[model samples]
Target: MSEPKSLEGVFHLVHMIKRHMHEQIEQLDLNISPMHMRVLKIINKQQTCTAVDIAQLLNRDKAQVTRLLNELIKQTLIEKVPNPEDKRSQRLLVTSEGMEVLAHLTTIDGNMNNKMMKGISREELKEFERITGLMTENLARAD
Candidate 1:
């Protein structure tokens, strides 16, 4: 296999990681798809998250975020409570069941992180994260 050293390599790595993560998510009996599970995580992190907030965080369109939120609601993984600050918007939160799933996903995430970073040092990882962040900002600005 060719060593990945460019932006294409970074994207390839992301795709491979996503594939394995999706497989791991599929092994759970929670009935939520990997996308829905990810939405749950966003809601869990931001108790007052709006669909717009989630859309921005995910770099997805508002319509797509709404679709994912709808699925999460149908599966009882997340709930949309009335936004006290804005009558037109609803705040998203993860349900008790979703929290449980998050806990399980946390373990899965840790395992994946460990395996993916086996030989990489902490400093290298930090530098990688910094570069990725810069790249993300560049893309965001281009959009």
Candidate 2:
């Protein structure tokens, strides 16, 4: 039997689009990578969270999360504070600089999403999200 064309095309398109978005961010002057920006976004939204929070949220390892936080701190885009309840734990927070970065990135993100949905109606967008959510659940269960 032949492979399903629609599935293969969707996979390739997702990969290509993600790669292009990364490339676009790479052209920016920021010292952070796309991964770091993702972390910053979570930190920004949460106000303060531990490295473990990021690790769990991103489905990444704690060591990797630590390294990313270290780099973000060095770049002055995020600040680390001692967790009030645990001296050994640290919480991450986005700096004013980080917010500025997020603001610009948010604009780009909105524009990209808008472009992707240009011809799709609101109902179509909702259906797309529902289908994607189901797909995500299926994949998670497969693991």
Error of 1 at 111 (Å): 0.7
At residue 116, give the lDDT of candidate 1.
96
Per-residue lDDT of candidate 1, residues 1-143 (tens digit): 35356767888998988887887877766576677767878788775799999899888998898888888888787888899999999998888888889998998789889989999999999999998899778877994
Deviation (Å) of 138 in candidate 2: 0.9
If scored against the real structure, what TM-score would every candidate get?
0.87, 0.87
lDDT of each: 0.84, 0.83
Using lDDT, give the best candidate's number: 1
Per-residue alpha-carbon lDDT of model 2 for 1-143, expressed as tens digits?
A: 24487578769968866776676676666666778878988998886688988999999998898899999898889898889978999888888988888987897688668777889999998998897798789879994
Candidate 1: the clashing residue pairs are none
**Strongest candidate by TM-score:** 1
The stretch of ten residues in a row with the least summed lDDT in candidate 2 is 1-10
Off by over 4 Å in 1: 1-5
